[model samples]
Target: MMTYQKMICDGFELNYCIKGQGQPILVVGSSVYYPRLFSENFSQHFQLIFLDHRGFGKPTRAFKQADYTLDKIVEDIEHARQILKLDDLIIAGHSGHAFMAVAYAKAYPQHVQKMILLNTATTNSQERQQQSLSYFEAYASAKRKHQFQQDIALLEQDLKREPERRFVHMCIRMGAHSFYDYTFNATSTWDGVYPNMEIIDYLWGVAFAEQNLLQQIHHLNMPIFVGLGRYDYLVAPVSLWDAMECTPHVKKVIFEKSGHNPMLEEPEYFDEQLIAWINEG
Candidate 1:
């Protein structure tokens, strides 16, 4: 772990931790959480700064639905960028955070040099979610399916016992779908995470679900990397992304032996591919 820091805003505080050196990469997600997901060796090729978006930073004051909308979240990222005095940065995100990263790039393309998205699906609509479920049923090993069943059987009980920690409990329970090694325990990775369910549910279920990303992505001229895990069943099928074409230098890389968190599950290969892409014209 590295030394942690904070960039407090008007109503909330975005915690950030920094490491590595070279080109700056602003990772848009939980400051504490995202930093743990990438390889430290990334410092050799880039400066990795993991900063939280408004959603993960849980403000004490009351906020309306309008406060945490995708636009607002993207602005929060811009706020962090300006505060840190970062320019021509590489914006990166994992999973749902990828929405914020891409949205930021769309809204402020001038500040971005490139973009990196890992384990990010095209959308999070009900249809996509259902597709992932069906894909899991059709493709997952029997052993993996069994573990999912076992984990899910306990989900309701866990949620009931800890309602405030609903998001964390559900993620922990979904180990089968989230990690390539279905039996792997990921509770430690989520140790200090505190999610605001209202913001998270709206963003994951609504904002990203209806996002017209292709049109927005087409306008970004910088290089982009979309990394996906072949075994990840939590998002839309990887084929959905593979089939689509965009105007930018958008490259897709698939990690055969990983799931949702390919950067963590396949860091060496992830770093190799990512560094290569970043350094390319």
Candidate 2:
């Protein structure tokens, strides 16, 4: 692993940690959280670097609304890339972080060699939220639904108790919906990860909700891999992705037995698919 580096921009102490060798894939989400999600052995197949944006990275101060805007976050990524001199990158982002990867690609296409967007939503809009709910209601097993209800019932009290940990609390409470194994505890993945709910509210609930990344830019040209878990309900469903304008360059693959964090739940298969995609490109 290379030395962990931090870049301060827009009052956010952005972190980027490099590990492994080969094609560089800038993993955008959390320096702590995403690093734990990927197989540590990925160091052999590619140069995987995990990065933190405002929502997941430590903030120097409370951000004014403009400070945490999507445009600024995209530029923050560019700034990190330039400062680190990352060249011909295969930028990757999981879940909502995929928005940053797409936005960065659109803004600085020359810097990107390819893309790997994992378990991302097409749109984070209310309609999509409702669709996810309906899917859960209609298809989820009674056992899963029961666990979800029982687990979510504790969220209110948990949040009230540790207001600062709202994000971690919610994710931990949503284990039934997040992992293939209903009782899988995600506390480890989020152990040292800091979440700024203020920034998350704007980015996940507002900024990303209004944008459709697939339709955001045309002629991206590079091979873009979209990996989804068959059981991931936290983000938009696979059907929504199927409805999008999937150009020839976009390759979407679904993991049959995994949930939101497929790389961890199915590490070997994830590495195989990801490496094959990289090699194919």
For each candidate, how many residue pairs have backbone atoms clashing (under 3 Å)? 0, 0
C-alpha local distance difference test of each model: 0.84, 0.84
In the range 1-281, model 1's lDDT, one tens digit per residue, is: 36578876657777888887777888888877777788877766777888887778858577889888999988888888888899999998788888888889888999998888888777878888899999999999999999989998998897788777788888888999988899988888888888888888999999999875555566678888888898888884788785545444888888998999888899899889888888885
**Worst lDDT window (10 residues) for model 1?**
240-249
Model 2: residues >4 Å from true position, as ranges? 217-219, 244-246
Give a tens-digit lDDT track for model 2, residues 108-176.
Answer: 999899988899888889888889888878888899989998999999998899888898888898888
What is every candidate's alpha-carbon RMSD to the true fold?
1.6, 1.6
Model 2: worst 10 consecutive residues (lDDT sum): 239-248
- Estimate TM-scores for all models: 0.95, 0.95
lDDT of 1 at 170: 86
